[model samples]
Target: MTDLLARHRAVLPSWMPLYYAEPIEIVSGSGRRVTDAAGRIYLDFFGGVLTTMVGYDVPEVREAVERQLRSGVAHTSTLYLIRQQVELAEKIARVSGIPDARVFFTNSGTEANEAALLVATNYRRSNQVLAVRNSYHGRSYAAMGVTGNRGWSASTLNPLNVSYLHSGDRLRGLFRHLSDADHIEAAAEDLREVLATQTAGEVACLIAEPIQGVGGFVHAPDGLFAALHKVLDERGILFISDEVQTGWGRTGDHFWGYQAHGVTPDLLTFAKGIGNGFALAGVVGRAEVLDSVEAVSFSTFGGNPISTAAGNAVLDYVLEHDLQANARRVGAILRDGLRAAAGRYPIVAEVRGRGLMLAVEFVRPGTVEPDPAVTTRVFEECRARGLLVGKGGLYGNAVRMGPPLTLTEDEAREGLEILVASIATVSAGEAVACGVSA
Candidate 1:
């Protein structure tokens, strides 16, 4: 290990996951590419865990932050009026699809979800939360409590009573044999059963991601959440869509992932993209629901001028450039390419995800058993070929790719080629060793 790696191991928590056997320190980036400490350029398919939405060094975002820096004002507590914060909140509310929407900004997705949970439990006067199996929210106590993936959930102790429901993963669920429509009905029925038995029927909310991010881009069938929402509605339970990974039109089919199910959440939490790598996240909900938080609360640096300025620029760029449409178009190309690769590679058990947020699952040939060995091999191969991706799922046997929404068709094809080549190399059982290159 390098001296820096040794220092990282010494200081950082052991549970903090790193990508490679020998991790590369990314130094700088432009567009969809990053250069590591050793001056090796790699196509960044993961986009810093989907936070770098527009791309690295985007001119508009840079100029906006630079302008804010020139103003000689940066931090002002949320107690004071901030123009950029208000404007950004307005934009988010407008796009949030919640009627009479209100927004509360936070510094990260974990805080945003925590705020959402606070609003939800307070509004409904209950602490029981419904979550989906194989789902991931965030790492904080409340967030981790709702998270269903065992790998991400660090402990069994939880702040709230959380009941896990079928997440609609067709590939690996009790209803995997059923058709899409039947699967939705089954999952909805499962939700009803869970609610009836698990709680006292006074649940705070059902928190879900339209697409499970850290769980290997697992997607519930379309309209599944809507079906479950009908049950929650009768019980007067709120719906909180965790859009930390699915927002900002990253899914391509809709600006918000919940829209694909034709449902509007009572509350939504977002991060990882709006500020294009800046620490900005928030909860958008109905005015009444947000107002339910009676205590005076404030975020010290949540909506500070600099982060809000970056957010405004990112949103403007997303709208003006129509990156959502680009994500749809190029993402289709990448998805088709991956599916085709799956056909060719026996280890590629599945290819899934919507738009740019995609994943390829590695499994034993002709079986659904996860092949994490092959997954690790393919990951190292991609790294050796100057491509950066991500890994997740309960078994850690999937490769995830969520390039910037601004990824061009050519870049998509290039990254796809590298990915397929790496998979092929691993599938061939090459004896190549893993680790960072010198």
Candidate 2:
């Protein structure tokens, strides 16, 4: 290990994982690529786990932060009214789509979800919460409790009485054999059962990721949440859309991933991709839900001037540049190329996701069992070819590709070629080891 890595291991929590076996120390980044400490450049497909929305070193965001630094204090502790924070809140409330939407800023996705849960449980007067299987909200005491991915069970800090609803993974769910409409119906019924038999009393809320992020970019049917929300609505159960990864047009079809489901959430939590690379995240909800917090509330580091300034610029850049439409166009190119490649390899069980958020799920050569070994090999091979992708899955066997929304057609093709070669190399080697063609 390098000195920096050795120091990192010595200081950082061991549970906090690194990507590669020999982790690259990223020293600089610009556009859609980053340069390692050794000065070798690599196309950054993961976008810092989907936090870098536009790209690294974008002038607009950098200048915005610079101006904020030159103008005033870095933080105001939310006790005093901060102009940038107010401006950002106004913008988010306007676009959040919730009726009479209100915004509360937090420092990260974990804090955002925690805030959302706090308001929800207080408003509903219940600690019982429901979530979907294979879902990942965030990492906090309450957020971790709602997470349903078997790989990440409720941690020791879990406090909420959370019950999972149903598996949302169409490829590996119990309803995998059903059609989309049928699967939606079955999942809705499962929620009804959870409410009837599982929950002790009035449930607080149901939190879900429209696209399961850390659970390997898994997706449910487009209208799945819409149906589930209908059931929750009847029971006075609030619905929280965990859009930390699927928000801001990353999913292509809609500005928010929940829109694809055709129902608006009562409360929505977001974090990643909002400030590009800055630490900005928040919860937007109905006036009543957010206003339910009667006590004094404010985050010390949440609405700092620097991060809010950067957040404003990011929203402007995404809208002015029409990056959402760009994500659609570019995402299609990447998905098509991957799908075509998957057709050639039985190890690739599915190519999933929308817009710039895409994933390739690997399995045993002739079966549906997850093959994390091959997935890790693909990750290493992609790095060798100057490409950086992310690894995730219920079983750690999915290669998630969430490049910057500004990814161009040529970049998509270029990255796709490298990924295909890496997958091909790994598949051929696996075949040789197994004494059969893959």
Candidate 3:
């Protein structure tokens, strides 16, 4: 290992996951490509965990942030009025689809979700929350409590009582054999049962990710959440859409993933791609719901002028360039290419995800068993070939790709070619060791 890697191991927590057998240090990036410490250029399919929405080294975002830095003001606590913060909030509220929307900004997705939970429990006067199976919200105590994926959840202790409901993952669920419509009905029924038997019938809210990010980009059938919304509406439970990964037009089909389900959530949390790598996240909801917090609350560095300036620029670029439509067009191309590769590779058990956030699942040939060993080998193979991707799943057997929404057709094709070749190399048992040491 490099000296830096050794130092990282010595200082960072052991549970913090690192990619590659030999972790690489990225030095710089432009567009969808990044250069590592060794000066090797690789196509960045992971997009810094889907945070670099407009791509790295975007001039617009850079200029905005630089301008903010040049200004005499930097840290204005939430107590003071900030113009950039107000402008970004107005833009977010307008696009959020919530009637009479109000926004509360936070420094990260975890904090944003925590604030949402605070508002929700306080508003409903209940500490009971409903979450989806195989979902990941954030890393805070409250966020991790609602997370269903065992690999990501670090503890069993929780601040609130959380009940897991069946989400739209039809592959391994109890209703896997049922039709799509039937599966939705079954999941909705399962949710109703949970609400009836698991809680006091007055739950705070239901938190969900339209597409499970850390769960390998797993998404439910369309309209699944809408169906469950009916149940929550009747019970007076709020709906919190965790769009940390699915927001900012990454899904291609809709600007917001919840739009695909045809439901307007009572609360929505956004991060990862909004500020184009800056620490910017927030909760948007109806004015009344946001105003339910009786105590005076403030975020020290949330919605800072610099970050808000970057957000405004990012939003402006997204609108002017129509990156959402680009995501749809290029995402369809990449998805088709991956599906074609799945047809050719026996180890590729399934290809899933919408728009740019996509995943390829690795399994034993002709069987449904997850093959994490082969998945690791394939990951190293891709790394050796100068292609960087991501990995996630309950079993750690899925390869995830969420390239920048600004990814071009040619770049998508090139990256797909490299991915398919890497998979082929690993499947043929011709892959070399990736220098992993214990």
TM-score per candidate, in order?
Answer: 0.97, 0.98, 0.97
Q: Write the per-residue lDDT of candidate 1 for residues 28-129, one digit (tens) a residue.
A: 999999999999999999999999999999999999999999999988789899999999999999999999999999999999999999999999988999
Clash count (model 1, backbone only): 0
Best by TM-score: 2
In candidate 3, stretches whose alpha carbon ends up further than 4 angstroms from where it belongs are: 430-438
TM-score (C-alpha) between model 1 and the true structure? 0.97
Model 3 Cα displacement at 29 (Å)? 0.8
Q: For candidate 3, what is the lDDT? A: 0.90
Pairs that collide, model 1:
none
Report the C-alpha lDDT of model 3 over 1-438, residue by residue, as the tens digit.
399998998999998988888999999999999999999999999989999899999999999999989997888888999999999999999999899999999999999999999999999989999998899988999999999999888898899999998766656777778887998898889988887788884799999999999898888889988999999988899999999999988899898999999899999999879989999999999999999999989899999998999999999998889888999999998899989878877788889999999999998777888999999988888889888999998789999999999999999999889899988877766223433221
- Ten consecutive residues with minimal summed lDDT in candidate 1? 429-438
* Clash pairs for candidate 3: none
Candidate 3 or 1, higher lDDT = 1
lDDT measured at residue 89 in model 2 versus the true structure, 0 to 100? 92
